[model samples]
Target: MKTMILTTALLALTAGSVSAQQVVRLATEGAYPPFNFINDAGQVDGFEIALFNELCTRAEVSCEWVTTDWDGMIPNLQSGNFDAIVAGMSITDERREVIDFTQNYYPPAFSAYAAMDPDADIEGGVVAAQTNTIQAAHVAETGATLLEYATPDEAVGAVRNGEADAVFSDSDYLKPVVDESGGAFVWLGEPVQLGDGIGMGLRKSDTELKATFDTAIQSMKDDGSLNALLTEWFGGDDAPQF
Candidate 1:
């Protein structure tokens, strides 16, 4: 009886250890504001970080956050540098060809143009956009001269430095810049809606993990918790309904 009990205890401990090892490493750009950004303390803190924590808890999975450069986010994910990406990545057919995404957590959002000159011509003037983003691709397809930067801040800086006529990016990310510009930067043109929405990215082989996050996302949507977070971060009625 004593021997049997000892063997059962050992098996239980081993099982618990295996379960504990099943942690998912979540990656984020940590540069996009209101979504994921490095705070004053130099720690990753934002809506996506908070949302990802909640989703991991609901999915019953352990998660560790990893910050990566925006341009290399997808490549690093494919190289197994991380388990998943929770950055402000939009769900698009072009991206879908390279990686699978969970159901969108945020609804489709619009991109806007910002420049020092309120009357800057968005169609024909030089524009700056972060490399490897939807805005960059859109700028390339337009009549504007596209200048690509490695980071969003760099793209914005181009406009401030007079290197580019305007900077085009996600409205949510650029709105705060315009607000804080103190009459220096202003909106240049009508905002354009792009992509489907923002979702977590995972490898094609990570179907089970994707399903776990998808279920958690759906739960948040059904309970209105996701909307609450969206409002808390984004503010106003612009948050899309689930």
Candidate 2:
């Protein structure tokens, strides 16, 4: 009886280990371009997707990608709907209170104002920003008439339709829009640098998962793979260094 019990326990332990090595579910907001977006094939594709895949490979883990709206991301994470968030989520103290974050993969960048009119008043005019984002907070703090949208694209649309005087968001996101706007939209003022940087969000209880990703991130940084990926996505040679 004792020998049989020992064999059963060993088998159960092996099963548990196998389960822990299964695929990790990674979530992202598929609407954010360059960072993460739905490609023409109706699949999530972008810098974040590529980077996450590489990270998983380096860590010898498998991953499955899922798209979730920005508003529900943190809530879903907390409720165990997914394993980790690879969305373009910035690292801030407020967010850190709710969810733990891996080391920053992307450095904190500037937020710029884009408007149809060059002389639009950034401080007093109606400024559109994606709801629940750092840009929205910045607009409110600056005493601007803040118009919150569900998506970044909608914020830009508010400016185009004259509903808002300006749209404030990441320069990486807004720059491409302005360039393709045929001179219709122009940057209004200097960009504002906010937050620490972008990092993967994980449940506070998932310390092992976080450590796995953190090690992968550090490995990429040490080997220059992370910087190479940044330049590939953001363009130019200004990729941040560790």
The 0-to-1 C-alpha lDDT of every candidate, in the order given, reads 0.85, 0.84
In terms of lDDT, the poorest run of 10 residues in model 1 is: 1-10
lDDT of 1 by residue, 1-242 (tens): 00100000011111121155576788887788989988887778899988987887777767777877777788888988888888899999999999999999999989999999988988999999999899999999999999999889999999989999999999999989999989998998789999999999999988888887889999999999999999889966865566
Error of 2 at 120 (Å): 0.8
- Estimate the Cα RMSD of every predicted model relative to the unseen true structure: 8.8, 8.6
Q: What number of clashing residue pairs does each candidate have, in the order they appear?
A: 0, 0
Task: Give the per-residue lDDT of model 2 (tens digit) for 8-56.
Answer: 0011111221145466778888888999998887778899988987887
Q: What is the lDDT of residue 191 in candidate 2?
A: 83
Q: Which parts of model 2 have CA positions greater than 4 angstroms off? A: 1-20, 238-242
Per-candidate TM-score against the hidden true structure: 0.90, 0.91
The regions of model 1 sitting more than 4 angstroms off are 1-20
What TM-score does prediction 1 earn? 0.90
